[model samples]
Target: MDVTSQLEWHPLLRDPTGRRTVKPRTRGQTMVIDKGLGLHAFEDLLQTSAPYIDLLKIGFGTTPLYPTGLLKRKIELARQHQIAIMPGGTFLEVAVSRHTVPEYFDMIGLLGFTAIEVSDGTIEMERTVRNELIRLSREAGLTVYTEYGKKLWGSTIDAEELVETVLLDVQHGAALVTIEARESGAGVGIFDANGECRDEELLDIVGKLPEPDLLLWEAPQKQQQVHLLKTLGSGVNLGNISPNDIFSLESLRRGLRSDTFGLELSP
Candidate 1:
């Protein structure tokens, strides 16, 4: 199995400008959120774009829906490629709401998710509990990634609040902090009702934030993706990408797409 020798592998278009991230990277990380993928489809995604994808999130509560065998297969495949696969944070929230946080950890650890999202998107979690969950997930041997923002429509970010949360999450052992744009990427946290990026809001946060690479912007729309790529450079970490768009997004990052063609590669 000579990987990177396959005819399908293309040379990166940018010559000296080529600086795509390597595995176990902190920046330029692309996360593909899987929402109930069947075994065959999941296999196809990894076989094709495993090189570009750093994380695979079993979206929302779909974690409980897949058969145990299929779920284990996905985890093993992802790990084989050095990709982290975790159940969505909302499922953890569900467990917390139902007083099943310990049970959630038991199931998640046993089920083979190497990462966990400690988020409070729908429910208002207590700060102490949130920190405890972060610590517990790490204790249970999962890469803890926390998210900030509500899932409600038209919800916008408070720059100061976001900065504080980002600092605390990183300090508490979060690998990264995901900005909540939901799966739709509309009417929430920098996205308008039409799924457009709110430049004013995004710019303000970016300006105030200390370490931009620690933030993974959830830009599910192509237009939004292009805008972020152009504004923040290819090294910006992005999330909530659909399975089919993995190569497309990677193309955009490498300036191989029409939207990014002739755009100067980031140094």
Candidate 2:
């Protein structure tokens, strides 16, 4: 039952874009948001699409709700597949609000999480606090992925401020900074109220970033995914992907889907 040992059809067809990298990739990373999938469903996801996933986030304040054994097993499974697993940033924000950051980091280490998301989607976080959190996460032996922007409806990106955040975050050892596009993928970050991408705004942000690959755009909807892929090239890092869309998103990245059929991904 070792899926990794099995032959893949990809070799036969040859990805049309010819730029998709294997797992443990530095770019083109796909981060899946697990709202609350049971053990079997989680395992099934890894068995089938582990190759396409780089980060597995146990979505928003739902980690503590799972039975301890189940949560640990899920983390173990993800580690076995070489996927970095972490609790969602919202949960961490709760810890921050309660002034229980020590307890949070302790529990995260005990639970076997390999990563941490430093974000302030719903809370107010100063740059100093954010930098310390990123430093703390690294000190705890965890990979840091920071998120920028608010989760409120209609929140949009400020190109100048975002560039500053990304620069400082990387300087502080963040692996990638994610743009917030809540699970709804509407009226947040680069997307408009209709979940359509505001191309000009998105481009402006990208144009300002010194390292675009250091960002992970949260595009949960298929249309949003297609738009980002087309606009940013197929190698852009993406986050907040739903579990069901793993293979579908991979298809889009490979130019195997109609929307991105002729897209050329960067090598």
Best by lDDT: 2
Global fold similarity of model 2 (TM-score): 0.95
Q: Output the lDDT of residue 18, model 2.
A: 72
**lDDT per residue (tens digit) for residues 65-147 in model 2:** 99999999999999999999999999999999999999999999999999999999999998999999999999999999999
lDDT of 1 by residue, 1-267 (tens): 887677564455442236676788877899999998888998888889899999999999999998999999999999999999999989999999999988988988888889999999999988889889999988998898899999999899998999999999899899899999999999999899999888888888888887888899998999989999898888899999999899999888877788887544452
Number of clashes in model 1?
A: 0
Cα RMSD (Å) per model? 2.5, 2.6
The per-model lDDT (C-alpha) reads 0.88, 0.93
Candidate 2 pairs with clashing backbones? none
In angstroms, the error of model 2 at 173 is: 0.8
**Candidate 1 C-alpha error for residue 252, in Å:** 0.2
